[model samples]
Structure formats: C-alpha cells, structure tokens
Target: MAASMWRKMRTYVSRKNIHRLIFDPQCAIFSMFLLLIAEVAVNILVIKKIKYTEIDWKAYMQEVEGVVNGTYDYTKLRGDTGPLVYPAGFVYVYMALYYVTSYGHHIRLGQYVFALLYILSLVILFDIYRKTKRVPPYSFIFMCCASYRIHSIYVLRLFNDPVAMFFMYVAINFFLRDRWSIGCLMYSFGVSIKMNLLLFSPAILMLLMVRFGTLKTLLHLIVCAVPQIVLAVPFLLENPVGYVVRAFNFGRQFFYVWTVNWRLIPEEIFLNKYFQTALLILHVTFLILFFVFKWRRLYPGVGFGILMKESPTALSPNQILLPLFTSNLIGMSFSRSLHYQFYVWYFHTLHYLLWSTTQPPIVKILVLGVIELCWNTYPSTVLSSSLLHVCHAVLLYGLWYSPDYTPNDKNLTATKVD
Candidate 1:
C-alpha cells in the first residue's frame, strides 16, 4: 500500500502534468475550486480570530436609518461619518442588510454575507480569466492569496466599495458574453450604488458604437441611464438638484489623512484645485492615447466613422476585456486619491494587466509584490506612495509595449462568446 501510494503521488507530481496545471487555461476550473475552498477556510479563520474593525458599518446603518424613517431628500441624510453621499442604490442595499442583521446589531453575520460576496466576485473574475486565457493558472494564486487588504475590505471593514464592485464585475461578465443590453443594465445598477463604475463608461461607449450602430448604441445608453433615473425617483421628486449634486458629487474632495496613493504630496497641495485639475488632465490624456493607439489596433486603419457603422466582426474575449480593464486602470492611476478601501477597485484586474504586458515574468511578479506591499502599509508613507506610483508606471509601460491581441476568430463574422 505504501509503494502504491508513492507511485500515485509520483504520477501526479510529474513535471509535464504540473506544467499543464499551472500554465493551461483548461486547469482554471480545478484551480478555482481549490482556491475557493482555501478562501472559505481563511474567512472562517479570520472571523474566528480577527476582531472585526468597525469603520463605516455604524455610519451606514445611521444613514439608511434616515431613509427608513421617511427621508427622501439627498441632502437631508446624515450619519456619524457625514452626510449620506451614496446614491439610492446604496440606501436600498444597506437597508436590506440593516434589516437582515437585526437592525445592524449582527456584525458576524454581515461579515459572513460579505465573505460569500467575496467568493462570488472571485468566481466571476475566474470565469473572466478562463474566457480570456490571457493569464496563466498560477496567477490565480496571487489574486486569491496575495492581498490581505482585499480580504479585509470585503469582510472585516464592510466598506460599500466591494458591494459596488460586485455589480461592476457582473456587468463585465455579461459584456464579454455578448449580452450588451443586460450588461449595460448591470453596469447602471453598479453606478447607482457608487460612481466609480463610471470609469468604464469611455470604453463601454466605444464598444457599443463598434458593435451596434450609432442609433442602436443610443438605445443601450438609455438602458444604462434608465436605472439611475428609476432608482433616484423618490429622491429626485423630493429634491432633484440635491440628488444630482450630493449623490453624484464629482467635485467632492477626499480627506488627506485617508489617502493611500498621494501621501507623498503635502496636504495643502493635495487640497489645491490645480493638483486636482492636473490629475484630471493627465487621466484624460492617457485615456486618449490608449483608446486611439493601443486599443484600436484590433481594427487597424478603421476610422471612427467606419466603426460607428457597426461591422459584423466579432471581438475576441481579450479584445473585449482589454480596453475596459485598461480604461479603469488609467482612471485609477491618475485618481486624485485612493483610500485603502479603494484597493478592491483595481485589485482583481492587476494580474490580468500584468500578464497582458510585455515585461519579463520576474518583473511582472515583482511589480505585483511591490503593489501588495504598498497597499498593506497602514497610514502610508512617502516611500510606499512612491513605490505604488512606480509600480503603476511599470504596468502602464508594459501594457503599451505588449503584443497586440490576436483575435480568436479569424473571420469578421463573429467574436467568440463561448
């Protein structure tokens, strides 16, 4: 029996099979299963050992309490933290949580619910990687295990960032599967929860124009807009201007103390209007370069006029995901500030973007590790902020030089959804 066991182990550990397990997309299902099991165990351990940090849970409950008690005016809601700035979707989602957890008294149960959310988000993300086949199976290990910050954001802190991101990924999945209408709807739902999802609007707009003609694209835009209007109806009826200004406050400045990305900058400069304007300019510039040059390589020599005509050519999974992910990255890279909780906004996409780059494998791994290090640093220092910027620069640089995507479909008839 000992000899038989040894032989079986040897067969499983053979070099070729191990290679296939890590390098092959076919192994993603098996890899995801094992990772998820480990994640469940980790969550259980975290809950059992780590004390849940109360950051915004109480504040969330208080804000929603106002809504529950018959307040619809966006500017009228207030909690311990500040005025209720999130949209009506946030109110609805957390209101459900409020009732489920015995009026926000049940913290552990909330953590468990978020743990489940974390798992579901991973499943959708894994599906994305499997469909794209852009990253190797081993990259999943880093995505699942490398970041303590991500786990805490979802479970311990109970920030609404993860909740908003959940819908965003769902929308991406739908878009990749060629269901544009449903995808737009889901994307709108995400935006109603928070505005960060709007970062993908530029890419999604380009995609809509390319896939459906200008007229059809406008219909899809309406699909995305209708949800926001419907969700905000009550608040809008009470105070339409307040709902627009408070819920979708684009000029809202973040506190310097909470900033994870701009700690190197002085607080005064960080608060200066010029700094914010500069960041916005840089963000728009980088996006223009990426959209016009790198992303358009899939349809070389095709002008915007022709693209608006809706060619029947199908986009590959990589073609669909690359632009969208890159758009978000550019937005995050130039963001005026990124709080610790904001890590979830771009964490899952880092692995895909890293592998999408032309950097050496070792360089890719090191960049990811440095980024993880930067995020893990509490009350981030000048050194950490600098390191984070360096890593982002490396990723952007690599993506630019990376090989152009090779479409799965050679013919223009269809992009593969399967």
Candidate 2:
C-alpha cells in the first residue's frame, strides 16, 4: 500500500498539462488589474479619512521616531502603552529607513517599502500558482490582489507584517525549490520579526522530518531557532523581564470590540483563563495530531531510513508546501483571539488552501467569498464571523485531508500541503 501510494503520487505529479494561459503574458496583466482595483478601493478609504488615524499608520510613524531619537526602545511607542508588542528584528528595517530621510517622510517611506515587499510577495505567489497547473491562473490572482487584508498591508495598517510576510514568501518559494536549508534559514528571519511567522513551523517540522529524518529535523529546528534567540538579544539586554513579557506574552488577551472573531462569544469566555488555556493546548494538540496522522498514513509500512531515500510524493516539495501552509493556518483558525490586521496572516494562504481542494468550484468560491466578506467588513457582524469560522474549518479540513491527485489540482492534502 505504501509503495502503491508513493507510485500514485509520482505519476500524478509527472502527468503533463496543455493549458494555454498558464504562462501567457496577459495573466500578469490581469493580476496587476486586480491589484489596481484594490488600490482604488483603498484610495476611496483614504478619501473618506476613515483609515488615516485609526489604521495604525499614525502609530507606526510614531514608533519610527524611536529610531530617529537614538533610543531604540519600543516603550516610547504612542497610542499603545508599555513596551512594543513587535519583536526586535523589526527595528532593523526602521533603523535603515530612519537614516534615509527626514521625519516628514517616515510614514510615506515605510509605506513605499512595505508596498514593494508586498508586491514581491505577490509576484512569488503568482509564480507558485502558475506552476501548480491545478487551478485557474486568474482565480489565484483575484484572491491575492482582491483581498482587503492585502489592501491594508499596503494602504492602511503600515506595520511590520508585510516585511515579516515577505520573508515568509521568500522562504516558501525556496521550500518549493527544494532548498530546505535556505528555506529554513529564511523562515527563521520571519519568525524573528514576528512569532506569528512560526505558525508554519509545524509544517516545516513535518517536511524536515520527512525529507531528512528525526535527527536532521532536530538540527534544522536548532538552526531555525538560533536566529530568533539572537534577534531578541538587544531587547532582552535593555530590560530582560519586560522584553520577555512583552515579546512572548502569549497569556495577554485582547478585548478590542473592533476585532472580527470572538465578538459574538461572550467577553466572559475571552477573559476566562481556563478557556484561553484550553485553546492553546488544543492548538498544540492539533498540530501534533495532524503531523502524526500524516506521517502514518502517507508512509505506511516504511521506516525513516527508507522514507528519506525516496519521497513518497512525485514532486520535490510541492506536496509539502500546501499542507505546510494549511497546517499552520489551522493553528491560527482556532486562535483564542484574531485581530483585524491578523486577517492578513492567512488571506492569501487560505486562498491557496482553497485551490488545493477537490471540492466543487462553487463551494470553493463561496468559502473564499465568505472569508473575504468576514475580513472586509469593519467591526464584523456575528453572522459573518460565524460564517468565516465555519468556512475556515471546512477549507482547512479539506486541505488537511488529501492532496487531490487530479492533474488540475495544485493543492497538497494529507497527500500534499499547499
């Protein structure tokens, strides 16, 4: 059975395709048009003056002033009190921007740089979609450019998300290419900037364990973790207790009514120490279970030595990428709290997970539509949040279960991770 599944996976990836628009030049144009549409939408928001003060842009600009003054302390941040919620690695980006221009150019400079990073991420995503040969090229582009979260990354909330996300995109791109070491290194940088980047860490662990083995995976994890530890050093030196508390404050909860998730859930549950703890335990348990099931199911009757000799899947890491992405997403989907900007974390990845499924096209469309609606709405209603949560479970469960073997399928499942 193990040999047969491996053979089946091999044949599936090797099958040929004859799609005309897969690599057509106009596909790029269509992608750009979708981005333009999102830009127009953001411009409309700018005109309304709705996003300027409330969007976190003003706060971001203030944070950079910390760099300009020679104190790199995050405690100086405006709006929010105490030390910065972001990791110290982000200071590197602001520090560079600080030397380049005057105070007046801070926000705009940050915007332009972050926008470019986001564009680069999109370009890489476009390439991944194009290579998949499983989904309509146009559909993936629409999801990428049409997202409100994507719009916010560039036009509204000017935080370190895009920069951290840029490293994630780069890491995934390298993973797709079978440069496992390089990919893991790049992933370290993303995690260093923001621990959220570690959402994909479970998937990476699975990949490393499969492609290398238990011992090598341990080594890779050490390699990946070193950077995160190093990045925290400066902040740790300034105020060890404060930095650790602020940086890894997993216990800290949010009650921002503006957030989409948990609005309908009684604030009592959100504040309930036990409920939050259960969710964290569940999150860790979920990853371990997913990893075990996948390992047993895919490599049945095979030992680690033989497994590493030849990957069961035909493609190098394509099968790994889909689940790697979705598994991490599964962690986020069940998060105790998800903020508005946090939606940016999964917008494109969820779309990719959607494409990986063998579910009916309409179902896929509705799932994406529901997720888009949930995030796009400000102060999301209970109805949309419920829909978003359900669809996330449905989409992730779909992506988590099987890598659709159909030639038209690009999504990796239990068989492949997208």
Candidate 3:
C-alpha cells in the first residue's frame, strides 16, 4: 500500500508543469526544512570560526543588569553605550539572559541562544511564505544563506534588533492566521522590546480597522496597549515621566557616524531638523497614498465610514502580509538614520515584497542583489547610498502598479515563478 501510494504521488508530481514544481508549495516547504537544517550547521560554524564582534551585547547586559540589581528608574539605568532607550520588555528579556548566561559573562552561550532565535524567526517567516505562496522556493536560499550581514547581526553582534524582530514576525504570522487579538498582543510585546517594531503600526492599524471595524478595533488596540502598560509598571512606579520619556523617545538624535542609509547627504543637512521633518512628511504621504489607492482597492467604493461599521471580512493571506511589509519598507526608505544592526528590521520580508511587485524577474533579482550589496557596505559610501535609493524607488514603483488580489481572486493562490 505504501509503495503504491509513493508511486501515485510521483506520477502526480511528474505530470505537473516544471515551473509549477519550482513554485510548488510542497517544494517550498521541503526547501525550507532543508535550509533550516543547513542554517543550524552554518550558525554553529559562524560562531566557532568568526570572532564574535561586541557592538551592543555588553551594553544590553549592563542595561538589564541595572533592572536586575533593583534599579527600575529609566533615567538612572545606564549602559556602556548609553542610557536604556528601549522599552520595558527589553529589560525583562535581557534580565533573563543575564541570569542564564552567568550574569551576562557567558558570551558563547548567548551566541548559541541567538542562533536559536534566528532559526525560530526563519520558521515563522517560512510559514508566512508557505501560506502566501508568492515567492518561489529558490528565494529561500538567498534569504537564509546569501547574507553574511544577517548572520553577523544574529550571532556575532547580538543586537536587540533581532530579538524585537523575532516577536514582530511572530505577530505577523499570527495576523496571517487571522488571530488578530493574539497578533496585537505579540506586536505590543515586540514594541516593548524595541521601538522599531512600531514602524509596522500604520499598516497594522489599517488591517485591524478593515478586519474588525471601528469599535472592535479599539478593543484590539487595548489588547496591544495592555502588554505595554503591564511591562512598564515597574519603571512607571519609579518615575512615570522618565519611563515615558526615555523608553519611547521619538525625538532622540541618531549619531551620524553609524548611519547606513544616508551617506549621500551632507552631515549638516542630515542633522538639520528640517531634513527629518521632510522625511516624516514624505513617509506620511506615501502611506496615505498606498492606503487610499492600493490597499483600499481590495474593497472598492468602501469608504472609511463604511469600513468602520461593516461586518468583519476575512482577508486573503497576501492582503494581510503585503501592506505591513510595504509600510515598513517605506518607513525604512524615509528613516532618519539606519544603523548596520537595523538590517534585521526588514531583511526577512524582502523576498515576499520583491515577489509581490510587478517588476520583471531580472529587475527583481537585480534589486535584491543591489540591496544586499548596499547593506553589506560598511560605513556606506555615496555610491552605495545612491544605489540603495534607486533600488527602493524601483521597488516602490513596482509595488504601486502591481495587481491587487482580492479575497476571492483565483490568482491569490496561483504560484508563478516569473
């Protein structure tokens, strides 16, 4: 019976189109499993062979150490790099790490732990791709094995960026599964770890409003806010003003020396308040346009007022994924400054976003290659920064014109390589 079943399966697969095979959901799953196994070995090899570069790990330990040693005042908590600027969840998470890794001295164990996180993040991301079936199987290789910077960010640098993103991706996965309440909770947890996760907020808000209507969306908003309130209670008790000011400071100035995305602009202009204001305007403008023209096209003639009172509608998986990722990408494009460690913010979403665009296959591949090169360039030269912007423009254009897939659209499930 087993042999017969295997033969039948082989025959069925053989009859399918070769291109379909490459884009086959089953093939994608198989490739993901293989990559996960290979990634485990690769992470181990990276930890063993490469010297773990200490950029923010020690500072993270110090910040959390203060909380563990009974310091809850956000103003008083200091690390080697600077004061604790991240939210309360970061404190709790790293405090656990501090204890487990021998008061934060066990560096090797920490690397191994982060390696586990990287794998877990990939698992969540793979599940998202599997559900959407937008990108082909080969793209998984580039996502997992092609980028040295991603590996370094996860294991070598031990930046809190990956930790926050791990939760963010979890939230995204849950959103794809239509578990909005849990997704909001997980998203708030990610925000608690680091503020960068908030970059996905505009998109999340749009999704919630569409899926649950206005009143229920407020309940979901409360679900998101409660975790943040619960997490910050300790710090809030010590100094409510300080906790609010430091942990979620939106006006904090970024150091020009470490910026990865704005090398083409002069330092004076980069530091100018007007420059940031302009970027903020551009960001808002792009988001509004996307929401009105692109995302809302899924529900034609459904205005904001209508959507507010309308019955809850089940969204296509890609509908849930695309806007959130595109929103982040737009934010990144207009960001004040992007440090090297910030790559993890949108790295995992690149493949999905690229495949969602209407650009030619070669254009998509070139854009991906240029982006990888741009991020990998240390201190980011003028040419690299310019090239990065060009790539971003190309992608934004492609996404703008790309076909919108409705919930009942047959094309939503059609997997195409080109």
Alpha-carbon local distance difference test for all models: 0.87, 0.65, 0.87
Higher-ranked by lDDT: 1 or 2:
1
Clashes in candidate 3: how many?
0
Model 1, range 302-411, lDDT digits (tens) per residue? 45864377656656677777788889999999999999998999999998888887788789889889999999999899999999999999989988876754433342
Ranking by lDDT: 1, 3, 2
TM-score of candidate 2 against the unseen true structure: 0.79
Estimated TM-score for each candidate: 0.94, 0.79, 0.93
Off by over 4 Å in 3: 1-21, 310-312, 405-418
- Candidate 1 C-alpha error for residue 27, in Å: 2.2
Model 2: per-residue Cα lDDT over 226-315, one tens digit each: 877787676666676766666667766677486677676777876888988888888888777766665344434336543354354433
Q: By TM-score, who's the top model here?
A: 1
Model 3: colliding residue pairs: none
CA shift at 137, candidate 2, in angstroms? 1.3
Question: Lowest-scoring 10 consecutive residues by lDDT in candidate 1?
Answer: 405-414
Order of models, best TM-score first: 1, 3, 2
